[model samples]
Target: MPQNKQIHLDNRPTGEAELSNFKLVVGETPALADDQVLVRHHYLSLDPYMRGRMNDSKSYAASQPLGQTFQGGTVGEVVESRHPKFAVGDKVVGFGGWQEYGVVDANQPGVLRKVDTTHVPLSHYLGAVGMPGVTAWYGLVKIIAPKAGETLVVTAASGAVGSAFGALAKARGCRVVGIAGGPDKCKYVTDELGFDACIDYRQHPDVKSMSAALKEACPDGIDGYFENVGGYILDAVLLRLNAFARIALCGMIAGYDGQPLPIQNPTLLLINRVKLEGFIVSEHMEVWPEALKELGTLVATGKLRPRESIAEGIEKAPEAFLGLLKGKNFGKQLVKLV
Candidate 1:
């Protein structure tokens, strides 16, 4: 029997997650039953949404049970299978958690699916062509519904979802502006990703200053906004919103640490008539096939460029996730479990 190394949630985090909250253990892989497949993970996705799962309170998804393997998306290859649908050597992507291997049931709907690595890389599926890409697509194409010649702004501009959102908006002939944490990220957002402008949020001391910078970047005012990091960034964007603008509320990393980070300008939504809506990507699986097809083509053709910040091993996942919450990562954060 092969020993499987796994990382489990040792304790629920009250504030920011600490390294002590997780534990690594080695276990034996069980014999495959009928309609089962054993997968050895190659890449594990470390996303901000996983932080919410660490809390004991109710959320869109269930709280990760203590002493269980931390839940996450994984891209891997089938090592063994008793299922008729899957065979050995099959490459798959699924919610396999933070482990070296996963035994997945083939009967579960939307749990496991094979991926083609011929056009796009395997790791790219976890970033650009997977959840993040579909997230960008949903917010941009479905929610924001931006028209050509409009101005669109996205927060966390250098991140996986935000970068893809900006690129997709630019492709639609919209002038896209990104708001990132630092000068380096701002430069990459504008120069590399081809955003019309990028505002370094760190350069501004307050929302007033940040709003002015946003006004300058978006001369026509923001017609569509893809919100990722909320709080002050949300307030700043609200202050500059054009009438009848659309806002896609994707994430709020500011309050992920169990802090009380409420929106300061709720009145803007009424005054500006902004269509602000929050969404969980998993709930909107209907449009995934359409979104993935477009995203995959863009990635394979080099039209869409999504970056990654990779950690070497499974043991490094906790630290990588912590770095992600603090904006230390450049793009999509991934753990190379292989």
Candidate 2:
């Protein structure tokens, strides 16, 4: 029997995630069943959506039960396997939670994908060339379908999905304006990601004034809105949407810790003839290969930059997740385990 380090939900967070909310412990690694594999986790992904899982409420997936390890995306190597597709020393990615060793059932949705890491960093399978990249591509091309010369706006522009959205839109000859939290993120969005303009939401407190600034940046009005933070900024964008505008509803990190604040400008959606649609990446796996392939080329050619903020050790997993929620991470937040 092997002892593994795991983080479990000690208590539900009241607002911002606290370090005490997670319990780190050493537990016995379970024996693998027939047709199962024992995976040793290398890296754990800390995504915003995981915040929703911390709460005991109805969602796409159930919240983590108290005393159970929190669920997440992980990249690891197979140590033992009863499955033919996976063998010892196979490098793969899966939903292995925040743990050092995982006994993965081969048939589950979070099963690992074996890959060759010689061409790219293994961490990327959790970021730009993986879920976030695929989510951005699917949301933009499939949902919004922006035309050339149209204006596209994305909030949380420095994040993995936001940067991907901006880069893809710019590639298609659409004008891109990004709304980021601060001056640093604003600079990164406009200078590094090649967006036409960026608005620092923190510097500008008034949404009405920010809306004016956005209108100045986009004189023709926004044709597509890629919403990552849904709150006042969303309400402001609503007032400036062009007729027949499309909104690709992604994660709402602004209200993730609490109940959603009522939008004051939802009527603007009807007044501007805007269409709003929400999406999850699971429904678009068929298009993932194409997105990853194209994103890989861009990354290899240095056209697209994938930024990662990594925390070392499985003990630091909870801190990394909390940082991601507080917008402390510059890009994708990941934890490196044994």
The lDDT, on a scale of 0 to 1, for candidate 2 is 0.86
Model 2, 187-270: lDDT tens digits are: 988888889999988876677888888889899999999998888888888888999999999888888887776788788888
Candidates in order have lDDT scores of 0.91, 0.86
* Candidate number with greatest TM-score: 1
Error of 1 at 178 (Å): 0.6
lDDT of 1: 0.91
Candidate 2 residues lying further than 4 Å off, grouped into runs, are 108-110
Question: Per-residue CA lDDT of candidate 1, range 1-338, in tens?
Answer: 47899999999887779999999988999988899999999999999989998998877889999999999999999999989989899999999999999999989998999999999999989988999989999999989999999999998889999888987898899999998989889988888889999999889858999999999999889999998888888898899999999999888888888887788879999999989888888899999999999889888888888889999999999999999999999999999977
Q: Among all windows of ten consecutive residues in candidate 2, which has the lowest summed lDDT?
A: 107-116
TM-score between candidate 2 and the true structure = 0.95
lDDT of 2 at 285: 79
